[model samples]
Target: MTYLVTGGSKMGKSTWAEDLALELAKDGPVHYIATFKPVDAEDALVIARHKKARAGRNFAVTEKHQGLEAVVIPPGAVVMLEDLPNLLANEVFDDGDVSSILPGLKFLKALAEHFIIVTNEVGSDGTVYDALTGNYVEALSFLNRQAACLSDVVVEVVCGFPQMIKGDGP
Candidate 1:
């Protein structure tokens, strides 16, 4: 089963995903697929925070900062992908506009492993933006939509609380 957890920045999405992964680890091994790049001090701190939070757990960590398409994941292992917005940022857009978002949609679908993905929901504020910023917002929105469509369960975390947007088993 695939689960998608989405919320804006500082919205506790990763915390929730980590909690779920820990719970799943009680039964078996949990694989964490980290995609964040530690480009600066702040990012490095964020990575450290995650590491500390998940320290000494029954899990295997695989950090994939780029080229996630070829990664092989184990079956029945709960996987959590932290905030995919950064991955979408690397795409080259058309017309020099870069507004399109078909590649991300395809990546999420091809991951035939049991896992949960965490992403930011950036379009909820409904704020108007310039061309470049607007394209990014649109891309995040599109990515979330595709995740929702492909996910077996959809969860929205608010104020550190998890609310199920979709559930398991028909």
Candidate 2:
């Protein structure tokens, strides 16, 4: 099962994705691919919160901000990708272009028995961002669309509820 989950910030997307991953994982190994790298105190808090959430969940977490092709996850592991926005940012600002993610995306699709990808919904705030942010939004939008196309199920979580936008429920 491949699920592409998206929602606004703090809208329970991550929690819902985690639960779904657990269900799909069953007795299999659960691997978490974290895209965010902590660069400040606030980032530390976010990391801590994620740690608390995954406590005792038996998740083998890997942080890959770039070079996703080099990931070492076990084949057929249930994979949970925390978010795509940060991954795309790292790729855009540091490593490579947005399309650079395609190979790694294909690799994951081939390796994982179950894949749950989480991303944020953007460009709806109606505030004009600078050129850099505008470019980022456009790139991420493209990335999310690609993910949705690859996914067996695409869901948008709103107010702690998942509204399925594609495919049947798992």
RMSD of each: 3.7, 1.3
Candidate 1: minimum summed lDDT over ten consecutive residues — where?
Answer: 92-101
Q: What's model 1's TM-score?
A: 0.81
State the local distance difference test value for candidate 2: 0.88
Q: Pull out the clashing pairs in model 2.
A: none
Candidate 2 residue 151 C-alpha distance from true site, Å: 0.6
Model 1, span 78-119: residue lDDT tens: 667765786666443322222333343345446534667888
TM-score of each: 0.81, 0.94
TM-score of 2: 0.94
Residue 50, candidate 1: C-alpha displacement in angstroms: 1.8
- lDDT of each structure? 0.70, 0.88
CA lDDT, candidate 1, residue 106: 45
Give the top-scoring candidate (lDDT).
Answer: 2
